[model samples]
Target chain A: MDYLTIIQILDSSLRLATPLLLTCLAGLFSERAGVVDIGLEGKLLAAAFLSGAAAAVTGSIWIGLLAGVAGSLAFSMLHGLASITFKGDQLISGVALNFLAAGLTVVIGQSWFQLGGRTPSLSGDGRFEAWNLPFADAMSKIPVIGPAYDELISGHTTLTYLALLAVPLSWWVLYRSRFGLRLRAVGENPSAVDTAGISVVKLRYAALVIAGVLCGLAGTYLASLAAGFVKDMSAGRGYIALAALIFAKWRPWYALWATLLFGLLEAIGNRYQSIALGDFVIPVQFMQALPYILTVIILAGFVGKAIPPRASGQSYVKER
Target chain B: MNKMPKWADAVLIPLISILLAFFFSGLVIWAIGKDPVVAIKTMVQGAFGSTSGISYTLYYATNFIFTGLAVAVAYHARLFNIGGEGQAMLGGLGVTLVCLAVPWPHWTLALPAAMIGGALFGAAWAFIPAWLQAKRGSHIVITTIMFNYIGAALLGYLLTKVLKVPGSMLTESARFPEGAHLPNFSEILAPFGINFSPNAPANMAFFVALLCTFLFWILIWKTRLGYEIRAYGQSETAAKYAGINPSRIVIIAMLISGGLAGLMAINNVMGEAERLIDNAVEGAGFIGIAVALMGRNHPIGILLAALLFGFLYQGGAELSFWESIPRELVVVIQALVIMFTGALDNMVRMPLEKLFVALGKNKKKEA
Candidate 1:
């Protein structure tokens, strides 16, 4: 690829990867703690709409971001209650949450905006604008990789940096912290964790709550950070995030690579459409389909066994 | 849905769930700024409101029965086949392709081709996920969901680029040849004073659905293969020990799921649209899961559940004729039924069985 095009791809990659990385890592937190999060998509969609509307009304991106997080937290708590407490079927409950979110958010969008869920677009001031690292423009003058590095990697929304930071943070929290160890313990065997004096259910709930907060950030990134909310702007990214979490084998750091790969795949399709490569393109459907195909191939044994945390789908019925 | 005694428990539990769902539905009508009593009256009027409405409800219920059976088949095998939407769409797609491409010298040849095409198309869709699950041990849930998207995207690409007919973004395949269109017999029925309108898409599919449900019931309750599937569903490891191949059962279940849902092609494509539409499935495949679940994955029960969905759909459609509630309110009602029914089904299945057995014993003594 040309230097300018290479730069463009990297820039686009980061932009696309931001949401997947943030949310997949979010998924890791919950699943690794043994709480199944089938409702991540619903949570993401709900957050995106709420934040998009909030940003347009308040004209403050930060407030919008908070709104997204708060909304997602509430959504996650629903997941927590259904799967974590009631011991309902995790997959079924998750599916219900998704159906609920898709309908309820549209209902809200309809009542508030009256535009069939096409929320008001945020102003430039209300968006998290692209930020160039200091001296990065000058660095573009360097050799073969220079242009590629500059255009694709240099300028991006503030969410990209936060998504990057989130990877390490997820790793640190999942592997290094005491709660992380306890959380992992809970996921592996809740009974053991409970026997050890830990409130296995509570810790898992906390993990889900944290995951919910992260999903809020991911949704806000799509709605307020990357662009404005345009109906199903989040689309199936929440589910994609779920796939990414699996592809990464639930490891927090590997989630970065998995998310980035998906982003790159998405960016390739995006670029193909823009470049008028229709004839050469393997149908946009196929391109749009790459992630799921890759996920199936990966999950279907290519990436090796991905044994979920032992207690992943189990409900911890507390002692009477 | 737990298997309980063969009588009153099964009946009472579903009735209770239905009653609860209807009550909640009345509340929804109230929230939407309509009098609950009037809304119920209106819904009843619109659904069975007239002879035509009854015909429409019958037409609607027929599709639900197929979709519900699709879901029930998988549940029997202990698999969650969530790719119903895609499979149903593919069924229509296949049937449409055959109807358009086949230069049938006569109607007899053309109709069968369409039917076979639809079934094979749906079978292929189900096979993809089933094969993946069997060989890879991947959860059917994940692969099926992903396939649902792929199927939708495939249809979208095909429709817009290749299959684009003369229309707006709503267009799909070319219109079917006259030989391929199913006969609308409302005119004939009218002479008997028991008319089902010619305008009504409802036809033999209702009978087909009942036959299929009965077929499924027989397959599950009587056949050795059915017994194997049930065995696997009950305990895969134990079934394996009993010499059943788990993979085979899983693949069979999924194939059955897709094929049953494929019958949608009769109603949705060849029966109704005469060609593909942008959203031919209208989320019927996914809703099938809720239907299957609420029906407790039993054939007779699924038929009942399908009737309820049919009522909501026909009633909801008629509402726009006189009311302001969106057609989507029906989906809301459907979702709530599954939700509330799901909880009660779990709680009531046990006690109802005991009651049914006691009643059966008393009846047997009287006999």
Candidate 2:
């Protein structure tokens, strides 16, 4: 309610929103290339577990990040092989990958750590520490603006800044680049792209790889948040990211705002058990369910029409 | 004309897929420095070694049968009803309300009433998603996924605030009346001189699951509605030309699917726990997808597949208890089965087709 309270909420919202932003952008790349990626959740979980394990074992956050990306990349490639190369059902592939990650992480984690499917608690360089921005201390001494800047803008991990940076970078890559045009074209009409001599398969694989990298960052950031890995740690955030993607209508800049809104909802839910408005009280469960309900409404076109790529969720078969 | 035999398509492909899944699961066990053979032996002994083990396996299978049939029914209409989890949760709520509302003198009367309540709630939960997909061009998959989360939240809130037993800290409903308790396997078999585990949760719901599977077969193969559903699934445009209503088929198929998913609550919630608890469905709804995939959306196949999963679950519990090999090994195997059978089918099918074609040529030469 107060300025400091508002700033504190915003601070937590940024931390929560970073993973969603990264994963949403990851999904954007995959879906924009005519590949439906419901496996985004699996990739996030896989990355989170592997990154946490790597960080704990090697005592290097960089290695953990790399391992996380590699884990996500493995799943992305598996998805590409099944849905694109084998021409199997994309949704089934995604669902299977999710189960695989959910099972494999705990199995491997338990076998290695013997801590009931959890990595050791990370400390020191194994974890990502918040970076205080330049002049943050001096800025805190000033009035309301200074405290707000220090609290809201500074004191986030490096990954948070990168996630913020990724929004513009994604917008540039998707809107301004030559590859972006081709990617959009492929998603809309892959046959036309094929006719134009661009290999649909190659473009899709490339898109999946990019998605894997972004998902890797998201997963590593998640591990950093917890300071270690826990079973089922992603905890449906990947799916929430998917909803955010739909809420944003698959646009990059819009994705940032959508994820931030979702993050704010989550922050509010964490901060309050219920919100009371005069005689009326809203339940926390309602807050938890709000994003999913909004997505359904958006999908049903009750709020705004969300039209996906024309060729999305379909495999491209070249005409003889 | 260049196709494998009907028997191969129905049986052999799935068989090979299961083998591949087991092979990979064994590899994972080995990678973790455990003996896969011993693990398998332990699982087999644990799931079927004693009457208790068998009962547990059957109990788990009963849940899977309901969910598997749910998925299979929707698949026939080409509507992937992934909202089974949410539907099942809602179904539990229905069962709870029905059992608690009337202190029934006998379960014989209570069972049918609970079934209706569960089916109605589950169908109601699924109706919005189905309607959206049928009328608004929304993707059922995404909408259903959203509904799962919403259902969980709704159930969590209800259990914590409205349904909780007064003065109890547990987030669960009060126990059902004694008369409403479905007879367990031990009680059911005692009159026939068959000794069964009294402690096992396997109950009359297993028989209900079998009955549903039979009904599912009749609905899919013997009825006009089933024919329409299959027709719609194969080609909606063609079915439309043939005067079948696509929207009607989608809605009906989803309703039946949701209803079947909801019926699973009778097994776990009413039969076993006798109370509605958080996470009563416990991933059985998702398991239904894997079961339907392996079974090729057929009733008999679903039964067999559900039993296999039931065995894996019971066995996995045993493995964890004995060898410290976390129970998640079963989940890993389930993932592999789903992957090889559903997503990576062509990886097995293409090679098999080539093999069959070559064998056909060899037969011609021999002739």
Candidate 3:
């Protein structure tokens, strides 16, 4: 109802959406090339855990960020090789990567961090601080919209900005660039690309590596910027990103809106832990289940018989 | 041009699969500064070293066999019923409810009734997604995963609020009645003075699981329904051409899968636990995926694979008893197994393909 409260709500939503934005965009690239990036969750969790651990040790957030990105990229490439080169199922590869991340992170963390799951809390300068956008704070005091801007924009870590920036960047790469054009062509019709004398395998492989790097950054944001890694910290966000990707009709801008919508619900869920509606109230569990329910509804309405890239899951055998 | 031979395919594939899984997991282990050999060895011993451990492992395996079969049954129909988690959880609830309702007669009527109740409940839960996929053109995989979340949250709410047992902060229900206890073969063994070991439960569910495996195998191979299921899995259009209604088969497959998942509750609630609720299936439902895949969706293979999983389950817990290793190492091993099983077919194909070819040629020569 109040301006300050509205600002607070937007602030929380952005903090939460950072991981979604990063992972969702990360997925956008892999999927743009027609590789279903189910492993995004694994990448996020791995990056988050490794980044947090690296930051804790080196006492530098930059090192943590790099390590996180590198880890995710490496893992994503593994997925690419398995699904793209070996002709394995993309979904299976992604699920394996997630299991690998989930299992490895916990095992290593319990052994190294010694906090069970709680990694040593990073101190001043060990974390990404909220950016102070000039003149924003002053405007935040004015009215309802002013506070909303402050909550949503003024306090985000640098990564949150990167997440927003990624939408247009992804759109440009997918729709405008030659690489994007070729990548889309390969995903749709690798044989045609091959006939055209372009190396379909190499192009798709490159696309996957890029996807890995993006996912890595997303993980770093979650681990270092949002909250440090918890057990299965990526939770089901990777899958949520997949849902977002599908609902986005595989478009970057649409993905942003879809992801934000999901983020909005999550933010609302956190805020309205238990809504006391006069006589009786629904518990948070029902509300927590709302996103998945909404996802089913969204998929039902929009994704029915939607066109996937032509060569999405097909393995190309070299012409003899 | 000629295809590769069979003998090499059979032997080479599983060998490569094992090696890759081990090497890959070893790299992971080494990266974390742990000795891969020790961790793995500890995992194996932890799961299967002693007698009591084997019994407990079998108990766990019995639960997995049913759930894994549930998954495999659906897989045979080319459906990914990830709602095994929800179905099993609901089955647990059903069994608990039945135990609450059925007055404790002898184990004869009580045990079967509990199982039937669970099977029906799980089957009903599964019907929703099956119907959606069959009639509405929805993807069963996505729908099932969604339903899993619904089941988790729904069960949490139900046990915590609407059906909260008398006094417990933990999300669990009240214990079952005294006579509602499952018929314990462990007790039978004790009375006969013919113990497999003092520690192992070695209950009737193990036999039930074996019987189910044989029955499923027969159904898959010898029955018309099973033939249709396999035919549909192979090619839906072809099956339809052959007069098989894909929609009907899809619904039946899911219903059967859910019923099997419900059987998982039979072991835990009727045999193992006095009562069960929220934490009923643990991650057996998910693990069932690994089990079904490892089993190659075959009933006999499922039995063996489930036992292997059971070993992993118990061994993980048993590792704590060992002085040097952490018990949690079992999870690492299980995770490794899943990763291997998922990627293994490619590795295993080369050798197994060779062996199959050789066997085919030998049979031809004899003919």
Candidate 4:
């Protein structure tokens, strides 16, 4: 409850929220374009592995980011090929990508690193170093704002700031741009967009490609956090992002708040694995389960309904 | 009116898909600087070369059969119940509770009681999601998947806090009583004068899985409930027009699905591990999705698909043990199978359809 403790918790929350924020935006891009991407988890995992491996091999953080994003892009294209071009079941395609990523990452990692499905730990330039604001030290001596700025706002990996910046950027692009208008139209009514000669397929694929890049950043952030890649490092964060997306009701601005809330919950769970509540001890497992349980409750109509795009999960057939 | 025969749809498509998956998997192995042929041969030999391997293969197959049927039953009602992993975890807890509540004199006496406990617990877990979907318009896919994570955390707590053996560091319950252990394949085959590996975990639960498959076939194809489920799956509006209540079918189908998923605990807990432990369900719940798809959501097809996955799993273990190929390759292979059989079916079917149409046109010209 103290000021410093609160700042410390906020710091952890910000770190945890970064991955979720990037991924939620990723899901936002795909879902808004009429694609249900359950494979967000797969893309994140693939990117994490690729990023870690590339950084380890090349000893350059920038190369790692490039390789990671490229890997995610390849998978995204595969998803597009299956769901868009083949007119296959979108859900099935997403699920398959998840499986493929889970398997391929470990297989390649073991072969390359020989460390039981984990990448070599990165150091120095191989990982993103924290950025210190120019006036952080000087400002820390001033007053409450100074201390708060230094403690809570100044130090984060470069990707964290990028993830935060992405929210308003996403909102601007989604609401204020012509391409965004076309993208939203394709999701809601592909036929109408088709009639307008806007090329629904191209718009949707473009959305997925953007999603791939964001997922790439999310994966890279995860790798940068630990400075290495472990097996299944994405864990269930991708699913958590999907839940966050639903919690946000598919809006870009709301995604930031939702992911932060989820991240805060996780931070508290990590800080207090066991807590004394009056005479009873609260288990951390309950805290860990809270986000999922809340999602179920929200979806059950305790809160307002979260409606997806009408054209989602459907293979748009032009002639029919 | 039709160029392609129904039999081709049933058999040839899956056959070609599996072939294509293997072909691609071979290329992957080749890319990794390994011999695909030797790798595959090793997998085959490992899965079936000995009585022990066969027992293990059949044992893994039993788990897949239960979970596969769980998915298939729900699929028939147009529900994608991805919570089988969670349900099976809860089922393990239920089985543990039943086994520990009182010491039973024999496996036969404990089996039915444990099955009932597991089924009810799993059904109860699924009821909320089904209700939400049926009455509140919650998407089943999202809720069920969310439930899997919740179920995992819940099970983790239960095993660590309530079920752990006293003074033990591991997060697992104490071993079941002697009489609670199911008879293994060796014991079962002894009366027939056949030799089998006593060490293998294959047990009476395999028969239970087979019975469930038979029951699933009857429920889906032979019974009125089955007709309602299929009708509902095909066209919800049409089913409603025909007087089948959508909500009722949804709840009933989910209940059956949860029950089938729960039964998987019998194979893993009482039959193999003989102790309730964390992660006992492993990834079998997700694998059930692939099995259901490859099986075409049919009982016979489920049996075949389950066996195929069982082969891959056992073979993959062998491959990792003998060759440098990683065990994760098994998952890659499974994913490929799912992709081809489920998502990319049109890739194979479109060409086959064109060929059949051409042949039919030639026949018409001759006539």
Query: CA lDDT of B171 in candidate 3?
Result: 68
Clashes of 4: 0
TM-score of every candidate relative to the true structure: 0.89, 0.99, 0.92, 0.99
Worst 10 residues of 1 chain A by lDDT: A273-282
The lDDT values for all models are: 0.79, 0.95, 0.77, 0.92
Tell me each candidate's RMSD, in Å, in order. 4.3, 0.9, 3.3, 1.0
Per-residue lDDT of model 3, residues B158-220, tens digit only:
888867666767667777888887656557577777556543555777777888888889887
iRMSD, model 3, in Å: 2.3
Better of 1 and 3 by TM-score: 3
Model 4, A1-320: lDDT tens per residue? 78888888988999999999999999999999999999999999999999999999999989999999999999999999889988888888898999999999998898889999999999999999888998999999887788789978999989999999999999999999999988898889999999998898899899999999999999998987889899999989999999999999999999999999999999999999888889998899999999899898888878888888888888888975
Residue pairs with backbone atoms closer than 3 Å in model 4 (clashes) = none
Q: How do the residues B1-367 of candidate 1 rate in per-residue lDDT, one tens digit apiece? A: 5345545455666677677767876676676566767766777898886777887888788888888999888888888888888899899888888888965566567766776787788878999789878878888888888888888888888898888865565657887887776655484476678756568777655676788889999999999999998999999899999999988999988888898888778877887788788888887887787788788899878988889888888888866456755555675567556655552354455566666667877889999
lDDT per residue (tens digit) for residues B1-367 in model 2 = 8479999899999999999999999999999999999999999999999999999999999999999999999999988888999999999999999999999999999999999999999988889999999999899999999999999999999999999999999999999998899999999999999999999999999999999999999999999999999999999999999999988999999999999999998999999999999999989999999999999999999999999999999999999999999998888999999999999999889999999999999999999
- DockQ-based ranking: 2, 4, 3, 1
Q: What does candidate 3 score on TM?
A: 0.92
Candidate 1, B-chain TM: 0.89
| Stretches of model 3 off by over 4 angstroms after superposition | A277-280, A302-307, A318-320, B1-12, B26-45, B195-202, B320-328, B347-367
Q: Please, what are the lDDT tens digits per residue for candidate 4 over residues B1-367?
A: 7769998899999999989988988988887788999998999999999989999999999999999999999999989888998888888888889988888899999999999988887887788899999999899988999999999999999889998988999999999999898999999999999999999989999999999999999999999999999999999999999999999999999999998888899899889999998899989989999999999999999999999999999999999999978989989998998899988988889999999999988999999
